[model samples]
Target: MATLEGPDVQASDGESDDGEDIPPLGENDNIDAIVESIWVQMAFDIMYVSPNPKDHRKPAYVLLDQEARTSTTPATFQRSDLTGIFRSVLYRELTSSQWETVVFDSFFPLPNSAALKRQGFRAASYYKKWHHLMARLRRRDIVVVRNELRRQFRTLLWVPHPDTDRMWRTRSSMRGFTRLPASSTGPCPLIAINRQALQGTRITLNPPIDDVEQGEMDEEDF
Candidate 1:
């Protein structure tokens, strides 16, 4: 009679700390099972791109570990699928005009390797990958549209405030005028103009003579 040992138990026996032991092969092991496990792990892993506030207009790619509920910034090549998924979500959220603005204003004229190096941008590899993804989006080469409902998506940058008043006040320095009481809508009211305090006195207009030149001619004749 042969005694049976578990795969882990046999592998761990006499293994050194520096190296890991290869588990003994089991009857149930197969290539398909291994590949399926890999695919399942990939499906659970979440990733996205968002604007980095500290880095001005530059975007940051982030990996969200679902099990741990923690996140880390990952390289572009490390997780292209996540980037592709987020790009699709963004495309769906934006209108055609908005998409044009985002593409043209945000990511156009992609920085070259030399420029990235000069600027000391750490995520140069990620940006290169992002550029390729953007190119694909422009070409409409997307094949798989992932379910955005499954993930928590965020924008690459802080979305600007839609309220014009808030945007104006926050963006510009009010130089001369004093900001009055806040209104329910529109900009803060400026200090009211004091009509009573105006300096000039009102003058009455005299009736105009039809022939003022006639008085001048009589004076010359006399």
Candidate 2:
């Protein structure tokens, strides 16, 4: 598998200005929160790739919750949780033919004749015309939707991993999830929760507190 390095942050003379002012990094803020916010804002979904039992070289996609955490202490992510970043980057960089092979042949093996029959496609006819059918559907159309996803993945993974402590780190960015000091014992509110997944109940990193207390806590933390 080819690995792509994260985007270069350095500005080049040929780069065009978007006219938006780059906000100065706030005091005590780290790169992790910024990247997480971007992912949340974009509503990117997470995916995991696992080797097929039938063939180790073939991979399969296992979708996962974007907000799910494997652990709370020194936060860690399952290999499956991080596959989204890898898939997105690979899809963006690979040629259409290569992408198709990766997705259909490896990630999702095409159904065999017996399986195709079960799915209601005439196995014989479908198999005979498979190449022609694929040729009719432009790979560009299928792959275009992934472009934004790939961009977001690259941005999130651009940050270098931070030194590990007891603090939870962002799975994708490999950095502390919050800028809170290691010594601070205050409960940090959960990053946004998935209400639907939790039976419609919300889980917050921090519990509700009085406005004055909240203000004071925010000041001290930041």
- Give the number of the best model, judged by lDDT: 2
Extract clashing residue pairs from model 2.
188-205, 189-205, 189-206, 190-204, 190-205
RMSD of 1: 26.7
lDDT of each: 0.25, 0.26
Instruction: Give me the runs in candidate 1 sitting further than 4 Å from their true place.
Output: 1-18, 46-222
lDDT of 1 at 186: 21
Worst 10 residues of 2 by lDDT: 159-168
> Residue-wise lDDT of candidate 2 within 1-222, one digit each (tens)?
111112322122221122222333234433344333333422221111111124444332222333432211112211113232221111012233433332223211221212222221222232223322222222342133234334333322111121112111122221224322222232221121111223433222221233337668889998
Q: For each candidate, what TM-score against the reference?
A: 0.19, 0.18
In candidate 1 the C-alpha lDDT for residue 92 amounts to 17
Model 1: per-residue Cα lDDT over 187-210, one tens digit each: 221111111221232211121232
Note the clash tally of each candidate.
3, 5
